[model samples]
Target: MVLLFAALSATTQAQVTATIAQAGFGDLRPSDGFLVQHLQHGPVSIGELADKLGITAQGVSKTVIEMERKGYVTRTASSGDQRRRLVELTSRGWEAIYASRRARAEVNRQLRASLGPGAPAFLDQIHHLAEATGAVTLLTERRLRP
Candidate 1:
């Protein structure tokens, strides 16, 4: 019974993630997702994004190069380090990410409404109950593969 529930939850989450990813916010991929996440903290080294995304720096660099061509990101020499470059969103990129976030929020709102007001509290309980076995950890620890 427990395993069945586990499988069901995992399958549901996987499907949800797939659906969200496919939405793609109409871009190549959510490379902007990582950029927006880091940009909140300030500039990030191009190298840092590759590491955080868990892809080869070469892969990340290639994607960034493409995004640069698309004007989704701008790579400028780091103010303090000429040898390094910092990646940042252009105005259009900011617009793109904000649009993506709004899209996700709408999905979340729909989910919450479907689940009812108790859903958030119930989810917290589920997390607590699943703690030692790390069932929910899989959601957070998911390492996307290319």
Candidate 2:
């Protein structure tokens, strides 16, 4: 249970880590803007995005509206399903995501360098353990909630 809790904590912390790192946006904060960038993961409906992120459809819709207002994401009706709206990231949103990812990579490299050596082995071991029990797949969905 301790490991499970730790994993959950780490996941939640990571969700906000990039936002804090990319602070100083005008309208949308780093976290919300970051989500906007990810909005281009194909034509996803509210329920699909909510299911993947463990949020309610209403919450995802609210966020989508905010992203649209910020010009980060655009909403379009699905051709086959008029009732379903899809979210797509704008070019500006892609820029934010690319820049944020680059920044994160730089920070990660610096931290790894400070670790001195054998970090790859350590990371490999962690990945091995993570894969052993489908830990990465346990991304916490509403279906899995109590």
Candidate 3:
């Protein structure tokens, strides 16, 4: 029974992960989308981005490197603090961010359409599950909560 439950749990997690991956824009991961969203407002230091995303500075650096290589972001020396580097999205990055938002919207539309009148309830349950599972940060959970 325990083994069967474990298998089921892994399968469910894989399905959820696949759904999220498919909902993202192009090859951008969720972390990339978060970085792009923050950069859309203004330039931010890698440390600050890491703080907001609750990730390690090294993780942010790796993602920034990938984003820079992809022409989605640029790392420049901060005028205010030469020791620190600021990350700003390029025009391509802005386009990618917008596309990500659209893709997420489309996913939501499809979910709602599929769920029909039960969509809200289904989303509420999902939100609760996410909170319980610590799938997102407390800050993100608060933002998603009513």
Candidate 4:
């Protein structure tokens, strides 16, 4: 019975994660939307983005290429290093960023409302997990949407 309950709990958690990822990310892949959100701050090198995202440069380049084709971002030569490519968000990209923020905010609001008095404790637990898992580093670099 205990093992069954544990399995059920894990399944429920996975479902919740998938639902949030689908609703919050919308049309773009989760990683792609995250990259767009990161670019909202300003331009960044592909290498820098890769490092921040904890992904490979080649992976970042592939996504950037797709985003570039979608007219969400532009790639230009870096001022200090012509060899480096800087990715900057376009107006469309900014729109995407805001849209993603709104979606995530709505989900978070609903989650908090459901948790009520437990929200703070729940968030604290999540923060601890993120830190223990090293996700805090990547999360801290991105702005938390209100």
Q: Record all residue pairs in model 2 with backbone atoms less than 3 Å apart, i.e. clashing.
A: none
What's the candidate order when arranged by decreasing TM-score? 2, 4, 1, 3
TM-score of 4: 0.65
Cα lDDT tens digits for candidate 1, 57-129: 7877787788888777788998788989888877767766666666566666776788897998977876797
- The TM-score of candidate 1 is 0.65
Error of 3 at 109 (Å): 1.3
Model 4 global lDDT (CA atoms, 0 to 1): 0.74
Q: Candidate 2's residue-wise lDDT over 1-146, tens digit each?
A: 77975885565446545554455334656447434533555667778777766678898899889878867778899999999988888776676667666656766676578667888986788778866867655532223221
TM per candidate comes to 0.65, 0.67, 0.64, 0.65
Query: What's the true lDDT of residue 130 in model 4?
Result: 69
Report clash pairs, candidate 1: none
Error of 3 at 25 (Å): 5.9
Q: List the global CA lDDT of all models.
A: 0.66, 0.66, 0.72, 0.74
Clashes of 1: 0
For 77-144, candidate 4 gives per-residue lDDT tens digits of 98888999999998877766666666556666776898999899978987897699676975676732
Candidate 3's TM-score = 0.64
Assess the local accuracy of residue 128 in candidate 4 as a C-alpha lDDT between 0 and 100: 91
Q: After superposition, how far is residue 11 of candidate 4 from its true place, in Å?
A: 11
Lowest summed lDDT window (length 10), candidate 3: 137-146
Candidate 3: lDDT of 55?
A: 80
